[model samples]
Every structure is written in structure tokens, then in C-alpha cells.
Target: MAEAGWYPDPAGGEGYRYWDGDRWSAQTQLRPGGTSAAPGAGHDPSTPIVVKGSSDDDEDEPRAGLWSQVKGPVVIIAIVLVTIIALIWALMQLGVLGNRGPGPSNPTEFCPAVTDGNYSVDPHPRDGRVYGGELSYPQLGAPWSAPTVDGRVPFGRDVQTQTITIEQNYRPGQNWVASVLVGELIDGDGFQSPEAGMDMVARCIVGAFYGDSPVQREDVTRRPMVVDGREAFMLEMHLSFDVRGLQAKGETAIIIIVNTSGSKNSIYYASIPDNAQQYLPTARDLVNQLRVGG
Candidate 1:
């Protein structure tokens, strides 16, 4: 009470008590085995009871200790977040995730020539306008004209397919005939898993063939194949479709799917006439050469 000065210890301790101008703040010092003096007891005002350490220093120790306790978990959480970010960056660099720009960082590569005298081979990256990602596939030459859209394809609308036509003769005489179609649905949002991308493409092709048509998929088979050292899904089925009101029949049709990401994918497909079994070996060879990206 004496003008906020040190007084006799009120808590019955040997040390002295500090009284602020208004209240008795919990600030005290302990004496060596001496009991606390009663309030207003005798104490020298001229001889200040100096504490060896600063009060601020003493108070800060508890807070620092509390922070140290939480620091371990906080550091662990930060390390985990950094690891996740690094993994995602690595995947993007590998292009397992969708390419961020106009095309893959590296150009796509195609299979080498694996054709017999009767068959021709042409390897080139598909036109970028068709799909933005890198794509390289073999085209059975000459008799096979560049891929064309069958009927009026609405792309993302009614159906999705990249139609390739093969004929013994370019036109007029329809001697040997076959079709190689790469089918997939690519929305504006894109895909994350390569498998999912292939699935959508396969569904688009199946829907196009099965919708309002008498023919149904037959001899369906599923297997794993490799493309550019990456695993791909292969589906072998027999089916037919109406090309311009003319029903074209084929056997041993095949569909190969490679999942590049959730939004991007590649599908290698073909349907050849059963009578043209001689060309089957060549077609299969070409399909084996299919690669998604370099």
C-alpha cells in the first residue's frame, strides 16, 4: 500500500510482496527459511529487495516451453506437406499428369515399320488440331486413305470416334475393306488417369456401334499390352456398324487403350474382314507399334 512499494510478504512467505499502485499482483520473492511477515509489518523501504533475475525473463520460460512441445508436430506436418508437393511435381514432370501446355515436353514417337510386301507403313504424329496432346500412330499405307470422320460426327455431342478407312482399292472397287477407329470422349475438363481416359473412349465407340443397331459385340476379350514401355489395355471383340446406310461386318476387331492421365488417353482400334485374315498379322503388328508419347 505504501505507494506501490515492496511490503511484507502477505502469503506468509519469507520473501517480500510487490504491490502495484492499484492491486496486489502475484509478484513475490522467497526468503531462506524465514516466514512471511504480516501485512503492514516492518520492512525497510530504503533497502529495495532486488530479485536476481528479471520478472519478464522468468515469465517467458513457460511460454517458450509450451512452444517447444508443439514444435515437433508442427515440423512433422510441414515435412509431410513438402513431400506431397514434391511427389506431385515429379508426376507432372513425367507427364503422368496431363501436359500443361500445347503438347508434351517431348514429341511423340511411333512404332517402326513392321509390314510385309502386301502392306505399307506410314508413321507420323496425328494432326494437333484433332487432339492437343502428343500422338503418333501407324497408318497402313496406300489402300488406307488418311483417317476421315464417318457420317456427320458431332464429336462431343452424339458420339466420339477417329475413323480410319482401309480398302483394297482406293475407290470404285471395294475389294479388301477394313476400318481402324480410335474412339474416346475428351471433355473440356480433361482426365487424370490414363485408364479412365481409355474407358471413356471405349464407351464412346461401343455406344456408337450398339445404339439402334442389330449387331452386338461378340467374342469379347480383355488383356494387357505394352505401348512405349507403358502398360495398355486391349479389348478384342467382333462387331459391325452401318457406314452410310451400308452395314459393314467384321470379325476379330480390337481396341487398345492407354491411360495417360485422368483427362487424356489413347485408343488404338481396328476392325478387319474375316476373309482378309491374311492382313490380320500385319494389322496386329501395326497395333503393337502404337505409342502414346515419347
Candidate 2:
């Protein structure tokens, strides 16, 4: 209907007419001067259609149009979506979306060497209610000391006092471990196996209490020394109903629960296998070994 102003795109699809703001331009022409000869005449189909240059005065140009049909709203939307994803990634690197509780992760590099000696123990407080015998991992000789301390685990303050004790004594039952092999703990509740994906750091120990006969492996994932001949692992989970974190009441704390199967029973991870390793020592002392009131 109106004049245009751009050039023709050979690769553009059929009827892919673009506005140059002045006239029509086509790549493969059916006739000379880009005009079809009424289609009835016995005409040559492969006639070359030569395009003439615009004879407008070089100095005299037309005004800009209302809107560009080429770069439409859909193109704009795609660009916006890409921009949003980029921004989210940048924010995570800046620690903006970081809500993980203050604690260091397990020192994966530190492998507790295996030897032949006493190795099973559970370091939880006196649970008078539940009745269960102690578990014992056969034996791993002299406990493996971290040859070189890479980076220590981290922990939070104030939140460490009472909860860390529970995290330090958690153990995984054999069934739980076996279940984890099949499914995943996607919902943060051990989708397939309860032990595979426990509810919290505290539950990690409690669930392993009576289950898993003939304790097979030592809880040396990130366990620390409890007694002279035992290795232990303690973990603190940041639990809330939903949303991956504790929101209201600002209750950002960890439950330090530990458990082990050994010669006697009971184990304590001197430090917790927590992201919040910094605050674990204090939490361990207050919750497990502390003496209150003078």
C-alpha cells in the first residue's frame, strides 16, 4: 500500500518482502523490470529482471517512518528473556541468592585412611525413650588424620549452641543407604530412601539408630575424632517448612546430630561435616560436653 526503503534479502522466505521505505526488490525475477507480463503471453520464463538505481536527488531524503516492521515486538521479547537469565546468573555469583547456612562443606579431599582397629560408635545424648543396641563398623586401624588441612568446615553463631550436638551424632542405616542407591532426595526428604534423603541433619543420625544390621562402613564422610579410636561425622541441616530456608523468626540455625556404631557405642564429630564448620566447636561443647550453671 505504501512505499518502502530497504534492500531485498535473497535468503529470506517466499513473500518475505522487507520495507526499504521506497520500492520493491526481488532476487529471482519472472520478467524484466520485476513486472510479470500478464502471465498469458508465450514469454520467456528465465528473463533477467534488472533493477534501476533510485534517481532521487542525493541531498533530498524522506522522513523516518512510524515503526519498523523488520525488528518487531517478538524479536524484542526474545532479547529481553536472554537479558533476564544473564542477570540471575550474575546475581548468584555476587552472593545475592545465597541462603545456605553458614558452614563449610565436607572436606572431600580428606580421606580417613582405613586400618584395622576399633571403629564403630554413636555420639548422641542419652535417649531414654528409644531402645536399640549399638552398631559397630568392623574396624579401621589408627584413625586417619587429615594429612594437610585444606579448608575447614564453617558454622554460624548463636544458632550453634544447642543444635550442633544433634548434627554431630547422626548415622545412616544400611537400608537407608541402600534406598539412596535407587532414587534421589529431590524434595530434600530423600525421595526414594528416607536415609538417602533425610528430613534434616538431626534425622540423618536418628534414622540410622536401629536399622542396618552389621554396620558396614565407618561414618567417615566428614567425621572428626570423638574418642582415641573412633572417627565420626556430624551434619547440620538448615530446615524450614518450605522455601529451602528458615524465613520468619530468623531461625537460621543447625541441628548438630551425630551417631556411630562402634565397640562401646556413641561417637562425636569433634567438628561437624557442615557448611558452618566455623561455629561447630562451640556448638558441640555447649550441646554435648558443656556443664551448665555454677
lDDT of each: 0.49, 0.27
**Candidate 2, run of 10 with poorest lDDT:** 176-185
Please give the RMSD of candidate 2 to the true structure: 20.8
User: What is the Cα-based TM-score of model 1?
Assistant: 0.40
RMSD of each: 17.2, 20.8
Per-residue CA lDDT of model 2 for 111-163, tens digit only, reads 22222211212242342211112211111112222111111111101111112
lDDT of 1 at 114: 18
RMSD of 1: 17.2
Q: Which candidate tops TM-score?
A: 1
Please provide TM-scores, in order, for all candidate models, with all chains considered together: 0.40, 0.21
**lDDT (Cα, tens digit) per residue for candidate 1, span 1-294:** 356656677778767765645655354655322334423345443345556677877888888999999999999999999999999888866545652211122221211121232122223345431221233455556555555533211122111223334444433564335656443323433235444444344444555433444443443666766667655677666655443334345456776766644454555566676645665676577665665553
Candidate 1 stretches with Cα past 4 Å from truth are 1-133, 147-177, 181-200, 240-249
Candidate 1 yields a Cα-based lDDT of: 0.49
